[model samples]
Target: MLNVDGLKNGIVIDHIQAGMGIKIFNYLELDKVNGSVALIMKVSSKKMEKKDIIKIENVVDINFDMLGLMDPNITVNIIEDDKIKEKIKLSLPKKVENLIKCKNPRCITSIEKYIPHKFYLVDEEKSEYRCEYCDEAYKLEF
Candidate 1:
């Protein structure tokens, strides 16, 4: 095992799917942070064969909903005073708006351009999201 410096306060995002770690890193603007940031990819996991972890030092606020869309299985640890303060289990959002553009050609968002793409969760089990304007169904897939 490698020794990692403990952070005073920040976030530790674990359980990221191996290659998708960088995707979330960019999505969350973690790479652009001036504070300490560490991204570990393809680390050993007991539950998962492989996983990725991201550590941000001195970060106070983070958008968890976007993180969930980037990778649904991610685990978040709130670090305080070099200790694990809290553990957050992320879940797919009930609804997503303007995050994903409707791919359908005839979709209202595509035609209107100005109107934001909005979707409502229709099925949590099936991960189905339906567009309010065009009725286009989008499956929430990472």
Candidate 2:
């Protein structure tokens, strides 16, 4: 019977895998936000058995690509006037830049300081990505 108030205008990040709420919270820099933010972890869910939820009291700019990369199962709900205005389903991003670094020692990215690390989805089922320059593979583990 834990009760949390509905947001009048804000964003609700739902369906975060259990134990990931803190990571998402930190990634979003919620601690530095001036508005109210509630991070509820380990909530019961029939779909996931356990999940985390983050409620922000004011709308904030979010990088959806980074969010998707962190957890593709997450859903973003935009609230306005205490009602859901939009529901966004996240999936693995097809392309990402500067999010994941090319770990290959001989990669050009390692030699060039000005280059932005870039990766492209190579295998969706395996959550695998390849470095755009070096073809080094990186896999995301949920």
Number of the top-ranking candidate, with lDDT as the measure = 2
In order of appearance, the predictions have TM-scores of: 0.86, 0.97
Candidate 1 lDDT for residue 80 = 88
lDDT of each: 0.84, 0.96
Per-residue accuracy of model 2 over 67-122 as CA lDDT, tens digit each: 99999999999999999999999999999999998999999999998999999999
**Worst 10-residue lDDT window, candidate 1:** 59-68
Best by TM-score: 2
Number of backbone collisions per candidate: 0, 0
